[model samples]
Target: MICFMKNNLIVSIQLPLLILFFCSCSLLNADEGKEFISIFDGKTLKGWRKAPKTSYEPWSVNDGVIRGEGKENRLVYLVYSEDENLKNFELKFRYKMVTKGNTGVEVRTRIDKTGKRPFEGYHADLGHVGIGPGVLGAWDFHFGSGTRKEFPCQRGTRLVIDSEGNGKHSPIKDAINITEIKKRDWNDCCIVAKGNFFQLWINDKLSSEFTDHISEGRLESGFIGLQLHDKGMVVKFKDLFLKKL
Candidate 1:
């Protein structure tokens, strides 16, 4: 009886440790072993579609790049329609803006057709404000379902978003050099989303990081999109790629 009790204790202890060991190994492999796949063929928009009630189709493939140009009165998106909803992924692309244009990349966002807005989710903003000209690389949430229209975290901020679509920002350590971004020129953007953790980079520089703990408004999985905010601006995107984690 004594020996059986000792064996049972050892087994119970080993089981939890073994589970932890396997979980750590899986996470390490997921970060290092996964390979990126090109979602855009560089020559077409075959796997993407415009959101519903988009007044006009402003996106097209030209010269090996996906281009959007128009004077839209509201938010417009070219959403990736091929994959199942993405839960955790890393996405990268190159983009260029022309003539005071405003644009962004949307991740883990859903189309809200019932409302006036076309999408409901997060946006990684790209463009110049009064501060300067280049990729601001700010983080924002567009709340289509609630009274909150947008929650914005300025450049160089590490933001925390709560369940009610509100945010608080602080200066980030090892922030990216915003000067390195080339205005009106092609620059690389990378976004990593895993669970409620998120990171954004511009031109290989770390831009922003955030943890979303919104129990009520947290988004686990949704579509990917490129945004054209308004009229009289041209935005071009290319080399769109993703790696599922």
Candidate 2:
């Protein structure tokens, strides 16, 4: 009888400890993602600027959103001019391809104060998937001398850029779900960068992944920019948030 009572007591004690252990694990998992801070005020372009030597006519803020238009049929950039030069971070924003041509987010980018192109760095490419190919859901590389390497990792693909700046790519099935994205409507976009690894998510689905080992061209830290590419493109962005990883 005494042994039975002791066994019951032990079971009761062990049960609570197990429950506590599980609860702690749950809390840790919940906190795994880093915290983000608002980078856009939604009312004004307070912390952003047009790339130097570029026209500001393409960008505006209205109704708590940033809008860009490719009225001139030329490349332009609205760059994040704040002090933070991010090396490893996650950027979250909502984008709407209003009258789509080509639009994208630029990260780890160096702004050209007086060059022909707006910046040099990696591009998280986006556009109306209806536009197709190079313009739609891809990763792009830019150089300072008005050169572009388009679609290193197109939608539903993975890419690796070797030390010699050569890219090897492979398709990733279901990485981008076209049916899940709303056309002519707002969509959630996320770009995560850690070391040389990068990921692009559209509507919460992984769209592309890239690993950069291009010692000659890869950038470790730089500004962020929103791109307005080619003619007749209209894009809107809001809820710009950044989480340093």
Q: Tell me, by lDDT, which candidate is best.
A: 2
Estimate the overall C-alpha local distance difference test score of candidate 2. 0.75
How would you encode candidate 2's per-residue C-alpha lDDT over 147-171 as one tens digit per residue?
A: 4344357778899877766789888
Q: What's each prediction's TM-score?
A: 0.79, 0.79
Question: Model 2: runs farther than 4 Å from truth?
Answer: 1-34, 54-56, 112-116, 145-151
Q: RMSD for each model, in Å, please?
A: 14.2, 12.0
In every candidate, how many clashes are there? 2, 0
Q: How far in Å is the alpha carbon of 142 misplaced in model 1? A: 1.0
**Candidate 1 per-residue C-alpha lDDT over 1-245 given as tens digits, one digit per residue, 9 for 90 to 100:** 01235578787876775344223223322677676778888777888988755667789898778998866667788898897488798887778877676788888888665584677777788874333422368787776665453555767888887766667878877677767877778887778888888877776666877888876657778999888877888888887778888
The lDDT per prediction is: 0.74, 0.75
